[model samples]
Target: MTLRLSVISASVLLALTTHSIAFADDSAFEVIEVTGHHEGSYSSVSTDSSTPQVDISGLLEQLPGAAVNGNGPLTGIAQYRGLYGDRVNTQVNGVTLASAGPNAMDTPLSYASLVNSERLEMTRGIAPVSAGTDTIGGSVKVIESQASFDEISGKVAAQYQDNGQRSHLGAKTNIANQDHALLVYGDLLKGSENTTSGSGNEIAPTTYDKNIFGGQYRFNLGDSGNESIAIGYQHLETTEAGTPALPMDIDFIRSDRVKLEGIHALSSWELNWHLAYSDAKHGMDNFSQRMKMPSMNARYNNADSASFDGAISVGKDTWLFGIDSQLSQHNSVISDPTMAMFNVDNFNDVQDDTYSAFAQWQQDINQWNWQLGARVKHYMTDAGEVSHSMAEMMPAIKMLMTQFNNADRTQSQTGVDLVLNGRYQVNSELSWIFGLARKQASASYQQRYLWVPMQSTGGLADGRTYVGQMDLELETAYQLELGADFSSDKLTISPRVFLHRIDDYIQGVPATDPAVKMAAMMMGDDNPMQFANVDAELFGMDLAAAYQLNDSWSLDMNASYVSGERRDIEDNLYRISPPKVILGVNYKSNNWLARVEGLGVSAQDKVSKTQFEQRTAGYGLMNISVAYDADSWMLKAGVNNLFDTEYEDHLAGYNRVMGGDLSPGERMPGTGMNAWLSGEYRF
Candidate 1:
């Protein structure tokens, strides 16, 4: 019974007192229709591209039940519909952190750096307990665009890509008036070593490097901004990155983050607050960035982490109240730079904390427009008391670290979340929506403290090897959704259908402990795995559309379909993602713009023999882009796989780096035929 919370989220204080824009050519896909009392329908996607995304999961795969579980090419694990890693919840720029690589390869969308990210929002279905303290596999927001309440602006960009000869540059600056404002940004990206798979080979020399910089300070107490405060700072540095599907590689990762937000305007209630902090340090190795191992199998790992989250809110005239929090701590070790007596503690003194409280209500009732939210969350995890030196000559790893150090590694949990949403605006171009939810999660301190056998499952790169699960439970979800929207004046569409049903669903099994299969066959792996509690069920449908066949032509589309199963072992559910579609066509006026895209996917034979999975076949691709928007200069170009098709991306990951050209658990191919160029400037 311990809870520590800091809450805020009144839509991030109405998006920090509003007025934010910094999207230079966000490539349209616009579809908005609201009436008689509203607010809800999303998509802010546009990770500003000219193709040169070494990360940000390729712009979260163009949203719509999104997907990306690549694990190298600079990692990326974020799945919306079929839940992914720590059950997805990330907010960068608004801060919420933890991912110092426990095999996540620095996931959490790799701290939103796709060359100075600007927007990558989410919230289309079943998310809302005021958006997070864990949305139970939902909640993503990475926004950065502030400055200009009246004055100096900034932007500078650069890009180049020719399949792994990649590069990107970034800059941002803004200093304002009207009671203070400032924003500073920096970026850099590097590459080489992905020679465009799909038989153009070279899938494992694995190279990548990254950088990001940040700054923010905002203040206003009257004179609009409705009373506000903001302070922020962020920095990230990654070096020698390469995750050939895990087993080490990534010589470094560093992070530092901070945030504080505010809003106040009393006169009948209005207050908001937000706080965030993070520190991450990570290092990995398996022969100094890939290949060459002897000297007792050379390996190294170092980890350090910290996270503090916040929220505080109050609103009136539509009711809202909040309290939310997060706290994280981790430390990992494991070394052997040629044996300093080969140490390993891997994860010691770890902790995962959470706290929350929420209440929300919105109303309109004329054409209906309602929302209801409620939440109560708690989780406190613990660890510490572990040791190893190859477990004193391995007595089955010293009896599983003496039975996980005499057991009782705490885990306390409490959860209750609910949401009821509605829209029904049968006029002004149609609308109908519904959502009901109940979500929760607990278990992820790398799934209850790994005491031995490792692949550090958090990234589940699926090379397999796992351990940890000390009375783990609590992973609920029960949801429903239905949707609609149809506008006119040149068409518009939005659709949805959903289901969730989770219940305990933790997954990963096949370690019928016999001292964890004799210490995973003396640490060489004999197929050990564990992390149970299952039940599962997932259903989906998604769609988004646009038409407007005139006024410089337009057309857009997106599609998704999900299906996960394991309602008590009928199998199927483990890296699920298949069924996809995207289509585009555009033409803009004045200052030319052009686009043409097509993508299709489908052919994943419902695999997952308990993660012995492998099934992919089905692909299509095409792309083309053109832009020129000059006034202060802008130029863009693109040509991704225009006809160099060669598929195999069942969500990648499984090429355990050993040699070039992949093998040793194959399947990690997709990407070839590229062309990109970009330039931007604005002042």
Candidate 2:
């Protein structure tokens, strides 16, 4: 059986040699969200948090129309509101991960591991249709460090930061009674090289190294146990990381994951299921972690991907039904290793699959509270048959590789989605909500198997160089949302507004294939681009608030704004993320706590002249923190940009490596002034 499943996946990744921190009992949670509409958790990192930063969507971007494009230091990428990347939808426990380079640099929440997470949330606004199947830039979830039922327990943590002397360590262990449980974890992070609070230098390769291990097993089945099961395994390791807006960096990324879940209590519809599998092997170079290029512009790459996912659902009371699927495969290769006849074949045997079925309904009547959904999807794609240097180059890449290896690359499609939501409870502190949807997506095999013109496009880090388009179709969207939520007793609030009207909105135009713009102007790109399907529109608004001026002070705020455009011309919508705001002030006692925060932004000249995208200026920063606790132990301290401010974070990208202090297209500077501390203990 494949060597006993590879020796139980290498003994659960060498017994969770990465991260873990679940002391598991300090619990008390109560959420009644509507913040942006269905869920919008946005806070939770507990492990005696102190932030040596480990990008889990940049720590959920402190939530409010979240954002984070950042192309390095673990490859962030997760944007909402005005969409982003593969239009967001990142999950972990419920699987749906897929991303092995292709420019993403192994993103997919970089295989989440934030202080031994146990449910990282975000679902804000219209993610219905059972929350799967291409969630138009929305939905984020993660779960780890679970399996409890009595518990043997454990915990450990560490963190340190001094502008890029960063270091972190984590630990976790567990065992349970009441029907079995087991868990494990590990983490280690390292960094060096990072300076720039308006230019203090450093920046050669914003260094990093990472690792995260995992384990899980849960049990109980039948004999009136009503059934239950859980099994998981994980391993992620990244090395020599540094992605100066990517052109190559990170000489390694190895990922392996497996999952299985179940629940049954038949007799009355109540069975759920899950299955997952993943594998990734990535390698990149441009001279291993920055600098050195020329020796025929040395470069190297090797990307691989494999994914499988399954889902099942069944509900009892208010009706629910489901079926979900996602399967993927990819391959990439490139070379120049001192020109061994210079290779290529960027992608081959690519495949993409998705299958879905959904039905949902919820109710509450009386002051209203409905929900309805419907979904149907099926998409399949294929590719294979490609060559390069095994055949050599030039001649407009031999007329686009002989017209894409003689066409007919197979395809299939069928999509449909619908949703409607509502809420109203007008009184006892008000409430109201609304949502509508229609979504569809397809075409990603690097937008249909890239036939040349590089920059791979999956990460769309905007260093533009695209090429891929073969009768593309299926890209629909039509959404709307409106919101309100208010609560008294220490005040609370939420506000939202949204709109979208898209149609075949894939973007990146202007190539007009003259042999793909003469092979992208012979590789110097004088304006090249492809992957059509246009017409777009987006609108936005956001707000989240809190206050509790008594009982040891409190106050909070979050704001957002979005705008996209291109109703077939007149541009805008390449990186969307302009207005933003955040504020905080807190204090507590009887164990100590403190906070001070602020962040502001607003300057994005709505660029994107067909992916020329660039324009950002506007900044603000301030942060502070403190914590205590004790009982089992805890401590934390923080200082982030507490006046080291030097700005530039318009979704940090650009500056494709080149001996650095940033100059190659600038943008990509933010982070300086750092001071962190963390500690934890429990047993």
Candidate 3:
């Protein structure tokens, strides 16, 4: 039942299914239609690799430095490149997802399944301005199938994991005829999991149950290909047995989203417009027992947002513009035996609005391709809060409390991005590319409405609150990149290097209190402190290559290295980024494919003064996967962490009390040896 054992079994199952496959003559590296572009064009080229077929969530887990929070599938939030929450942007069918709070558990786009997607695109760093300006990490855009000739097209898949005694089943169908199209997808999953780590002793057996469902409809407007409307809905529910660090007695979530978009192409220019609305509610039951006081709490969160986007293109140059807005509200009331006399009730609401405009020019000269682009964006946030004493509502103990006050806050900022890129052919064997970008980050909601926890004396004490000073400046970054694409008859390789400089960083400071000591220990510099014009820099490189040694055999490799540091005199800094490397190889034949991958992370000497920081020793992990294609059917199986190696991902953040040691649920624990078997049929 161990995670390691499950991974091993999965590897064996994959090896048994694969046979041999012949290599095709088609180019492995070719430009394909991608949705990362706001204009919906194929002119943009990206280095992201795609699997033969995969779920949307599964595909995201494969990104470098990414991790999943939940035990099973489809229910967890994705932490990409060490960034989580609002730091990453997600757009589905031209609809953006933003939350009211910074908590990762309340992410907006958690879906039931993605089987009906026509295509999906992942772009890092440089995303389209229409996608919004908050994406400092990257962006993910999904394109669903809106038009189809078939009356119905669908598929079913299932997988079982031995380590956790887990099972998953998912299905999706698309029905289309004439002017209408309907697509539906759903998944059911259950898993009982155990961990193996330093905190394994404290780690308890966890069980997972989940269900997700979604549907979409499309209506056509004439045959001009310029007019159409679509609407979609997504819902998911999940329950976890909880962990030692944070126990969850109950959890439930429901969401609904709809979108409408239209396109018009005239002789002189092309026009496109989209509108979207979403509503979501997250309910949770949590029990926190620290020291003598045990607090049982239930919270209900409601969120809704809307957006509008449009673009106009003329000749080789085009200008695009859009507006994005969101509203979020949260309410929580706790029942505590020790703090019953204090009586606490918490409530807050926030709204964010953004507007942006961008221009792109694409020109082809001789054998070289050139691109130039610039985007300008303005961001604003409004927030307010209301608090009341439980005694005031209850008949038992009536206590006078401060009346609700308008804790109103307002902030505004403007930033711009400039990009320049070009590609040149040196010969049949080599091609060169160069790209440079300058990005600026506007003031976020957190930077303006600063709140620090007050020492406990009663329900509500004079909490230290400070209005954001206008002295704050926008953060900025300048980056330079160079890369090469090389290929021979049998082998293709690509390597790239990037350098970045960032300034005007903000960090939090801690308050002096005995009760908050434990909380402060885990907080590090994450507390809402002061903002300073600090400087930081990072440089990294990555390479990917594949070679066909013979007709039925081939090899593949991928690796990345990153190093970063913050130069601030006020305080010793934390490692915002760590050096990481991933190397993988594969062998494939007609009915069989096998792969081995290695993940390695270097030591991070960066540490904070109040925290006991130990440099994570470099560790490597191995994984393998394989599949077989049969007559009108295909069977796929795989094992992650083939070696059952105990290693920690460098991108992990801290929450556990154990110092420096890897916790069972701290990072994405590398499963020992797990196997999965899935069957697919094609018509």
lDDT of every predicted structure (CA atoms)? 0.76, 0.75, 0.47
What ranking of all candidate models by lDDT puts the best one first?
Answer: 1, 2, 3
Candidate 2: RMSD over Cα atoms? 23.3
RMSD of every candidate to native, in Å, equals 23.3, 23.3, 8.1
TM-score of 2: 0.34
Can you give the lDDT of residue 523 in candidate 3?
28
Residues 1-683, model 1: lDDT tens digits: 00100011221122223211112233432222222232256665765543456776667677767888886787888888888877877777666778887888887767775545666777787777776777788877777675545568787888888887878788887888888888788888888656576458877756787988887888887876678788888788998888887888888899888888888988989998888888899888887766674533787899989988888888888888889788889999888787688888878979899988898888888998888888898898888888988777778788888888899898788988888888888999888988888888887887788878788878778887888797788888888999887666766667688999998888788988788788887667788888888888898777666666667767666667778889987889988878776666777888887778777777777877987988877777988878788888778887887888888888876888775667778888887888888887887
| Best candidate according to lDDT | 1
Clashing pairs in 2: 18-186, 18-187, 18-213, 19-185, 19-186, 19-187, 20-171, 20-186, 389-392
Better by TM-score, candidate 3 or 1: 3
Tens digit per residue, CA lDDT, model 3, 46-160: 1212232222544444443333334223234444443334455666665665432223343434442544454445554344444445555456666655544336777676666
Q: Which residue pairs of candidate 1 clash?
A: 6-311, 7-311, 7-312, 8-311, 8-312
Candidate 2 structure quality by residue, lDDT tens digits, 484-540: 776667666666789989898887787887877887777788777888888898887
